[model samples]
Target: MIEIKNLKKVYAGATVVNVPQLEIKKGESIGLVGNNGAGKTTLFRMILDLIRPESGEVLSNGYNVAGAEAWKNYTASYLDEGFLIDYLTPEEYFYFIGGLHQQNRAQVDETLLGLTDFFNGEILKKGKYIRDLSKGNQCKVGVGSCLLQKPELLMLDEPFANIDPSTQFRLKNILKTENKNNGVTTIVSSHDLNHVTDVCDRILLMEKGVIIKDIATSSSTLSELEEYFGVGQIVTPEIKVDKEENH
Candidate 1:
């Protein structure tokens, strides 16, 4: 379970995100949807402890995520290409992560069996640095590595941004399988409603860094969410600034 209390972040003396409270239970999948720069990535970064929050706490199963190293081992995230080691091949990256988790090659191979088709037998081959791989292939490596350890809490930011439709569908099934069988708590942030609706048990809608709507997918329709986001308010292009640009 993940609990966030009054979480807030600031950049250059300006408030970038604030969430009063939120609790995501075990085996639950949640989706975050917002316009560009609405703080979805900021919130995800805070949860993963990659970025510090100016105020409040994030707890995973009673462990303070921002206060301990144990949380790092149990929390797995794949937000962008930087998460992958650009200098290493895909197989090398997997072996490196496996070593960190104290897993042998056979165990790593077993864990990676589900992804073999995606790798197309090339991930085990040598000679290609991760940076030389295509964006979609890089994402596959990042994702495969994150799941290599079977962490309890999984967080992904715009995971389907560069992947193809077939892989996106495969990823959706993989997320569902993980959540169902392993009871992993998953939080996914995406701009695409179809992706979210396909896998998320709950949906949180953000506007200008504030969560304006939280709906249970079982009880809500996609059209309802569309109406909420499409309220005809004029959102200026001023909100399009990237996180680094704003920093």
Candidate 2:
């Protein structure tokens, strides 16, 4: 279970995030969406303990995130590329994260069997560095590394950004399986409305550093979401100008 109360953040004299109260129940998959500077990443950072909030507290499983070490044990996050070890090979990175979670090499190997496709023959290569890999491949490694621990609370930010279409589909399947089968509490932040709509049980929309809408996927349709986002209809050819004719 995750509990948030009065969360707020200010940078350089401007408030970037403010949440009076929010509670995410165990085994729930929540999607967060917001415009570029709307504080989605900031809130995730605070929840992951990467940044301290100006006020308020975040609790995971009855332990305050900033104050309790035990609370962090059950949480795993992939907020950015920094979580990855640039010098380690993909296999080595997996082993390192597994070891940190007290799992042995055999256990790690077993866990990674399902993700071998993501490795694309890079798993056993000993000398290759993570930093040298493509951005999409690096993201795959980061995601696989985070899942090595089988965390109770998983937080991901823009997970599909750099991935290809096929890989993106695979990732969506993996996340859905993890949430449905293991009941892992998952929070995903992405700008792709369709991606979020497909898997999220609930969606929270943020604007100007505050949550402006919160609705369940079952209760809302994609069109409804587009409307809620306040964007007008998709412009068709009839509405678009003919550049050559205008010139």
Candidate 3:
């Protein structure tokens, strides 16, 4: 569970993020969707206490997230590759992260067993540093590291990006299972409407740093979002060549 009240962030005389009041309950799967410069990432950073808010604060359970270290025990986030220790191999990096949560090497290895499908046989024993792996593989490592903690709160930014379609579906199953079976409070941000709707029970539509729409997933939700996105949108034409030209 998380709470935000009058949260605001300003940069160069511009207000980037402004959330009036929001509360996510335990076992809720929430998704944030917005275009570029929409402040989704900013909101996430504020929640993680990575950025200082100009006005209000984020609270995890009953404790303030910014000043208290208690939330770290129950929180795990993977916003980007920066979260990974690039110099370390994926195995090393995972063990290191697991250690922080009081997980020994064997425990960490056991936890990794469930994640083998997500790893797709390319992650473990690859003998390659995380930085040397492809972007998608690196993403797998980051996600695996987060899940290893088994935190009460899990936050991921653009989790499906760069991952292949098959792997994306697998990741969705993992998140959904964790939320349903373990009651993990999950929050994720993505640009793909279909994917977000499929994974999250609730979705928030953001624009210009404001949460313009918050709705539970339904039969009509996707259509509503598609309609809204299509409004005021223009399609620029691209040059095309005939099939016979090459021949």
Top TM-score: which candidate number?
A: 3
Q: Estimate each model's TM-score.
A: 0.90, 0.90, 0.93
129-199: candidate 2 lDDT, tens digit per residue:
88888788888888898789898888999998888888888888888988999999899999888888887
Native-referenced Cα lDDT, model 1: 0.82
Candidate 3 CA-lDDT value: 0.87
Runs off by more than 4 Å, candidate 1: 120-122, 234-247
Q: What CA RMSD would you report for each candidate?
A: 6.2, 9.1, 9.7
What TM-score number comes out for model 2?
Answer: 0.90
- Which TM-score value belongs to model 1? 0.90
Per-residue CA lDDT of model 3 for 1-247, tens digit only, reads 7989989999999988888778789999999988888899999999999999999989899789888999998898999999899999998999899888888999999989988888899899988999999889988998999899998999999989989988999999999998999999999999899999899888888777878777888777788778878794332112121111111
Which regions in candidate 3 have their CA more than 4 angstroms from the true location? 233-247
Each prediction's whole-model lDDT (CA):
0.82, 0.82, 0.87
Candidate 3 minimal-lDDT segment of 10 residues: 238-247
